[model samples]
Target: MSTTEKSNEKRCERDGREKVDKFRRFLAQFCATTVENLLLFDMGLCHSFPFIIIAALTGFPNKHNLNETLSLTPIEASWLASIGYISEPIGSLLSALITDALGRKVAMMVVNIPLVVAWFLMYSASSVWQIFLAIVLLGLGAGLMESPIITYVGEISEPTFRGVMIAYTHFGYSLGAILVATLNIMMPWRMVGLVCMFTPIFTTIALCFVPETPLWLLSKNKTAQAEKALCWLRGWVPKESVAEELQSLQRYSERYKSCESCIKKDQKCIHPLPTLAEKLKELKRKQTLKPFSIVMALFCISVFSTTFSMSTYIVQILKAYNIPMEPDEAAAVLSYVNNLGNISFLCLIRFTGKRYLYLTILSILFLSAAVICGYGFMVLPIGYSSFPDLSPNFPLENSNLGYIPFVCIILSSFCIFCGINSMAWQMISEVFPYKTRGTATGLTAALSYVLSFIGAKTFYSLETTLSMPGVALFNCIIIAFGLILMYKILPETENRTLEDIEMHFSDNSKKLTDRKIPKLDLSQIGSAKNNSNMPTRPVSIKGIDEQNNKKSGIGCDNRSFVADS
Candidate 1:
């Protein structure tokens, strides 16, 4: 039978529009909530972008115009970098408290304050050293946006749709990277300061109407408020349905009360860490600390092994090729190509591919390109090919091999911005549990900056020590390992229920997403365990966002065929 036939047959058997409609509606409301929440962090880059861009242009260790651009001795530039790093994590720490208290919407609203102030300072910066202060302010703003946005989105969204929302946020990060790459080309680095200044204005305006999360209110024991929030989130659901959902909320709430009460009464008997029982309750308040650490490590590993430094130095890389152009004109061309690469990346997100495969494929492309470029330099005579050895300190097309790798980096960066960026956010969301998601995500972002800093420093440091191809090859190795881990440990969670997913993780079954909905929710129906103490019924909010297919998964044909019936 065709899909329509099977659906029609099932429809005939069901005989009730109300039931089907309720399930479908709930799915729609929660779709992509995580993505929007995560995307808000793009604003964190308002200050960080300028700091990194300015450093790339002038503070680069071996550059010729360092004294001219910075108006400082080369040694002073090192001091400026130290100031930038120390200033960077301040905003992230400030964000943690607000994210848990005021919620994501207000937290994001608060972040604009620092961003606006940081940008104003950057626009007026007089010396490279002055930029150190600007970066510190920017980091403070970034810290606020990162954790709350993740926390708010994860909390608001249903469990099944989580990965897609996270992927959307990852996409936002790529957009920010693209925005900076473009801004750098269209205007002088100083004008880039103005753009950062205004990001908060637009973000704040849009967030004014963002809904408070339903689950968050319930956890805080505001049952009436959770119901009201859900009504908006699940428009068109019948009034009777509200009562059912509210009942579920009550039970879920009591679970929280019971756990908290248990903690208080038993004290030593209740494990401070997540016991199998409290783990069921998500009672461990501090588990976010370790996952946050691992995620930061991963983010740093990523930035270090990638191309932010090289892209900022594109003109230099080409000049190293000894191509024939005045330094100023060559710089202009490099800026134009950088813009081109970014444009291609943004288009690719809505075009040829999406978040996951786009990531894996892009990683391969970047690695291949980096290796090709690295090999080109490594094979060249050490003095001439590496730097200072070749005449006029530029490649004059003797072997022309260096140009090939340079082209590859440019192309690979374009692919990476669109592709791997998507994959990173998608997996990060899945790996993290919902309750600690904000803290985990905050740490993820904090480390992302840390890595970006390291990546920037290492890109330059490696440039001097290793040939270009050598650097590319090393990064390739890193990406390969990341890809392998993802394939082995991760499951395809395109769509699944919150409880259904919990069961999978608890069962340690990586094969769940590929199967039909498990028997967990069904078994709860009319069970004696559905007593006063617990209300673990399947709560489906119709017309809500979760019903939508957030991740764009491949759906199979719905058919029923029998043999020997």
Candidate 2:
């Protein structure tokens, strides 16, 4: 342990008097050097994918009067949309290849390459085909930013505040949305693209200055670099605590040889050091996928559904409602509400435990609200819908009910942020083995994007066929899947280590289902002074042989007492 880590750990454990100081210390360790360094969040990457495009383009490509404005054929607009989805996952997959190899700082900087070049291409575009070409480049670059950022952020953050630190990325997403909305109003479409061309440059600069992840360094067996990186991350924590953390890190180091020595000396599992790919293969072969994986899958499903089903088309739904203002004005208010929702949701997420119960509750509320709002718009056949008559100069005006869709939209987005977004990353970082984290994260991300493709394509087709209520009903169904998976599968993660989680899931499923399972008697457990008073037999292992003991005395009727734990 370094001097600072020791001091910090001592201060953290000094009874209840130093709690405030401990928190201050924790925050100091957690924050990055710049706003751009904080771009590693999945929310930022997801938001950036579409958000940057909106700011750069500054107008809807498929506006009803496309022929008059841009003289775009349906084919050109379709080309851009098609390229968006295709190129998105390309960058995402690229990030996985680069994350561990390049480190977070370099990865972030590297990702800006596609973004900058794409924007430069977009800025110079004078035709619809040229814009489509830019989108392909942009998607390739932005896709790399998506999954890798989540893994990088998770790698760098301290365990206690990791959840909150990751949640802050949603702020970046909100910022992108709000910034694009403003640009759409004040700037010419091409000028907007030109102005945004500088953003990636700024982002790239900040990323270059951030520290590499200590965990990744340790995993690579670079103990010295790991300690140095960790010190930068931990600020002025105590040396003892730092030492303890380092010792824990050393356990993961290939050079430690503890796992190997254990197998060789004690004739246990009998293994030596394995490559990362081998370790991941072992984890998969072991069927080490935890119950928590369900939580992750469900969250991704919800995010994927929200990504295209509501996020991109929400403003479309509002305009479809025939609101009182122009499409631009309607979008502005909706953007404000969406950002407000993100900020408030972030605050709420900090107070939430790892239990995704709140997520389930939010999903229910959002679905209910969506059903009411969408049903009102597309299902109920009210005359003029309390709106003004359609005309050449003036389109139909919206009812008060027109805004309710946004209300539902905002709250549902909050569910995305607090429920699915935070929980997915938190659980993935905590549950997956460090040896296999990179591969597992990469695999999960690829799966997520595949589903995102489904969501985007499904939402587009469904919206045209069924209208606004159909979209909500579709959302309601996806949210239902998330709620069910979360309720049954999410394990409590607060203050618990990954080992604890693994052990829980590794235990027999039937026994875990027992309503009145026994608890450990702390006083009787390893009490040297009262060793005589301790139970002579292990509670769950009576009459069971040590080898292949899954049945746990099921066939034995002797009821012989166990002698030790």
- The global Cα lDDT (0 to 1) of model 1 is 0.50
Cα error of candidate 1 at position 256, Å: 5.1
For every model shown, the clashing-pair count is 31, 20
The whole-model lDDT of each prediction reads: 0.50, 0.51
Put down candidate 2 lDDT per residue, 1-565, tens digits, no spaces.
9999999988666644356445544555446623433453223333333432432233343232133234443223333444566766666666766876776567777777777777777668777677777777766766677555666666555545555665566566666656655665665555556766777777766665556776677766778877666665665444544554554444333322324334223222235566656555545522246533564565566654463434544444445555555555555555665566556555665566656445654565556656654555664443222111221122334466545554555555555555555456556655554545555665665556565555654554555555445555556676666666555555565534343343334334423222121222323222312332111223222222222123231111111112111
**Cα lDDT of model 1 by residue, 1-565, tens digit:** 9999999988776656544553444353444252343334455245226434534444332233234354433234334443444445556656655675676667778778777777788778877656767777766666667676666654454443344445455445545645665565466556767876676677777677556666567656677777666665554454554554455444433333343334233221222433434433442332333333334444644565556545445544555665455333544444444445444544444333333555456466656655665565665445332333322354344556655655565556545544444444544554454444555565566656665556655554565566655666677777676665544433444444343333334332223223233433333422413233222222232122122212212111100011001
Q: What is the Cα root-mean-square deviation between model 2 and the actual structure?
A: 10.1
lDDT of candidate 2 at residue 418, scale 0 to 100 = 51
Worst 10 residues of 1 by lDDT: 556-565
TM-score of each: 0.68, 0.74
